[model samples]
Target: MTQWQTRRDDGRAGECAGGRGAASLSGGPSAATDAVLPRLILDHARDGIALLDIRGRVLWMNPALERMLGWPLDLMRGRNPAEFINLPENRPGPAELAKFRYLPGSSLFQQFRVTRHMRRDGTRFWNQQSHALIDTGRQDAQKMVVVTCRDITDQVRVQTALERMKDDLEHAAYHDDLTGLGNRKKLSQYLGSAPVRASIGTGRVGVLQLDLDKFKQINDTLGHAAGDAVLRHIARALGATAQQGDLVCRTGGDEFLLICCDVGSKAALMSRAKAILRASRAPLAWKDQTITPGISIGASLCRGTPPTPETCGGEALIAQADQALYAAKEEGRGRAFFYTPELGARYRAERQLARDLATAIEQGQFIVHLQPILHLRSGRVTGCEALLRWQHPTRGLLAPPEFLGAAAQAQLLPQIDYLAMNASLDALVSLRDQGFDDLCLSLNVSSAILADADYPALLNWAMQSRGLPPGCISIEILETSFMNRGAPDGCDAIARLRRLGARVALDDFGTGHAGLAHLSTVELDAIKLDRSMVGRLETDGRTRVIARAIIRLCRMLGMEVVAEGVETQAQIDILGRARCPLVQGYGVARPMPLAELPQWLLENKAFSLPVTLPPRDEPSPAAPPAGRARRRGDNSI
Candidate 1:
């Protein structure tokens, strides 16, 4: 029984399997019977069908093939199916497919060949094809091929779209939107993985942490957009400096992290740090102005022996780098430092101090001390400079230098300043009640406080609440505060304070950038010579000339001059000869509590006549019952 069949485009055959269908094609009496069934099914099938001769020429095709491909069967006749099929770039080409020519038809359906097929109208659709071969059992038998195809264009489009969305999501998850660098998430993921942890104990991971110095000044002076531009510029420069396999990330605002793998030695790590420092120091042009930014860098090497994933944590590395970064800033910025245990200890101490500062302010653990400022001619006390002292429950009394920096870093300066000012006012009211009405209270005001527009109102409220006149309180401002003229509320705050009958004194005058220029623009009532200038008056002849010139200039400007840090008798003699009127330092009296001031004033005749200097460490008086007692021989003030 020979099975007759037709050829297909893929060199396969579709056979009429039943004897009844075979007899119908031969036009027997039962031609319209079951013999016509195979022909009917092929013509009306949902899938496209095609036939080809053994030489790979299309011989016949079903109506479904024409509908699926949008091509007329007559025009597709004798055309090679490969010409209309669009295979992916990675798919086997004709040359590779030729190797499978001798493969048996039975194995063709093991995997359906999916590819795109073009229509006569120049459009295309995806097709899944299955192949089979047929043979005519005759002396000169001709081989035929049958190819069945299904349109899968919709499925392919959906799959491709899904893959593109997946890629987009992955890119967004790992990359920073601003800098196009790996974000914290990516860094954490990398560090937690086996690759980063494997190098922990081997000292193969070097992390350099960089923080921009004075960036806050730029942000405050310029706008946020300009700040962002600066950050992008820095990121580009830092990224350019990265070696192959090194990753740079903007881990925080004005802070960056660089992770280097397989670092050879500590010197090599430092060399990289130096390069980054140099890059950071290079001036950048923003809005037609050249701005040179300084950077402090801290580097850490992972050298955990026999490291586990948890043993060398990313946070631990970052903390070590932070400690070194703090050291760099402490030594003065624009430098780099390697992580050291000493630095870590110092950072821990500073952190603990900052943490305690908030609590200290909350608990009102601070106190006010007054140091007498004397008139140069009569040697009489005219006013007192209010100084802040921390009376720790266990540490007794601590000077401002011990905790002031930590307070400033923790943003507790405003509260502490308020505390000091209110305390000074309270002491002023106490002294006024005791007939010390002429004495003025000079209190230092931070530039940060002046930057708030609400500060003037707050100050007025404090003074009014105490029933003290505004003229009795003199605000001492640091010289450096005038360096930036663009501070939003500083200049206005000062003007408002002066308008409210408060006298403004330019404190630490000789040490800052503000010279005659700043003095000309800023309205000041008094000029306090910085200690650096005063200390040199008795020692350095040139310093004496500069001091005399400054005093003369202030006198001409109608601004009173106060010499600070006047210690030795020679210094006082020099200042008096120079015609500097007011002096404030240890030569008159050390900073003492308000309760001790009256007795000290009586014993020394500080405000009326000439006062002699007491020996260092001499006990002045006992503390009041309400106030904490002072330790004898404790001359911190």
Candidate 2:
């Protein structure tokens, strides 16, 4: 048997020697030869165990401790654990450790610590260590500490991996996948955080909302892959443009929000918005095409000595910026605007009007009104133009100018156009039944409706269902409608309508920059001089010369000319002198409801005017009576 003994600091032997020490510690048999059992058990234990004296110097170690640290017990004897173990800095010092002494009747003084320990080869690993203080019975003997250490390196590795994965998940939840920018969730969280609120309370903060204009067209035309590329590119641009501590977030598709901290004034906020606008204007090259993207920005500033959350909340700031964005779009796109209370009121009103427009459409509150188109030579009613009027139940009759802007914003113009076309066809059917079978109808269609691929088929179906000839329907498109990217589609639609035996006219001509170019590119049967030109025809000589030249050009091209807004008799005389075939305005007849058309037609059927001949440079043609001259299907007025 290997007997163990304890030596005091004074080099005196204590009572805890031989089997007596084991008996005193474990309450076992007190025989020197019997000490072998406890020693054998300790040597075979899996965990590393060590014994330290009262001053924390290591006195003895089991074989497991030697194997765990790659050091023999003899070499570590009388050494402090601090020599091999890297204890945590927060661990108790000597003074604190002295307080953890063994008390009477206590189960045993013990403590557990997880810390890193260095092996003999200088590699480090985690160890879950437990310390217990032993109480010796003899007064002359010193107390001892027993420590057991379990290797926990694998468990620590697993815990570290789990923590890393948790951090990654949190990042993904708060960021946009496509752009890698902060997302709406992150924006909301940041704005609501205590730090940001404190900053807003003491300093100025600005919220800028950016919306991509014409993004839908690019997405629809070039595919979503291109759109995603554009979004990533814009994200980088915004990140570069933002100052330190500012946050750029991709709020949604084609829209981003920037939160600026410590903004000096509203002017500084607007300047930042302008910078963003300029950044977005740069063209992006995708595949074989260059896409020039445009953005509109709206900004809202919040500042006070101590602003309340109710006044400077994230939601309120975003709402204000949105209202400013609406104003920016209203004035013109690709610009910036700051929020104001008056602008918010206007936006709210328009929003309500848009909602009411949707309800109006559902309730069938819209009606068709027609103004007679009179032949200049005969002064007789030939055909009438269709005008849309809203019979608001509470607001009374509303003109197109009142609600058309809101309807456009609501994307309801196409629906309104379809309704007007159908009603006008029905009105034409009624006129045919009332002995005006030759009466034609002209309907004004917006660019969106004109560019729609399904419009021609819908029109054909409406005309067929009403038992009206396609020749009785004329489609009038604004000159500005053909000056956009959709012009090709509009031209294709016009061709389809013409093939269906319907005549097409360029309405409000001489108002657009590309009027003459449209005349050459698009095939049309008539051109309606806009009210601006006709209103100036009598007083402006330059207008007179331009009017003469346009009429002569159309006559030579075998296209009819209609003078619109001819309110004065002198204007009619001038148009007659210019050989304008048709004239329509209040001077001829104000727009009346479909129910009043038949009576008006009856009263104007016998009206006649003096026929005017063409000038010496042009070939003169005899004027036929208005009713018989230009019937449905006749291109010539």
TM-score against native, each model: 0.82, 0.82
Task: Write one digit per residue (lDDT tens) for candidate 1, span 88-119.
Answer: 44345666545434234457636688867666
Candidate 2 backbone clash number: 0
Q: Runs in model 2 with CA error above 4 Å?
A: 1-41, 53-68, 71-75, 80-112, 116-124, 135-143, 199-203, 220-226, 241-246, 281-292, 303-311, 615-637
Model 2 agreement with the true structure over 1-637: per-residue lDDT tens digits: 2435644445555333233122342233342234454675676678999998866678998877888888888887876666655545544566655554435344434456888877888778898987787779655148787889899999999999999999889989999989989998899789878877776876577899988888888888999999998898788779978988788999989999999887868999998888887888788999999988888889898844466665566678788898898788888899999998788788888899899899998999999999988876656677899899999888899999999989988999999988888888888888888888667899998987876888899999988888877777788988777666466776788899899988999889998556777778888889999999999987899999999999989888878888999898889888888888788999889999988989888877755554464555665333354446354324332
Q: Which is the leading candidate under TM-score?
A: 2
lDDT agreement of model 1 with the native: 0.75
**In candidate 2, where is summed lDDT lowest over 10 consecutive residues?**
17-26
lDDT of 2: 0.80
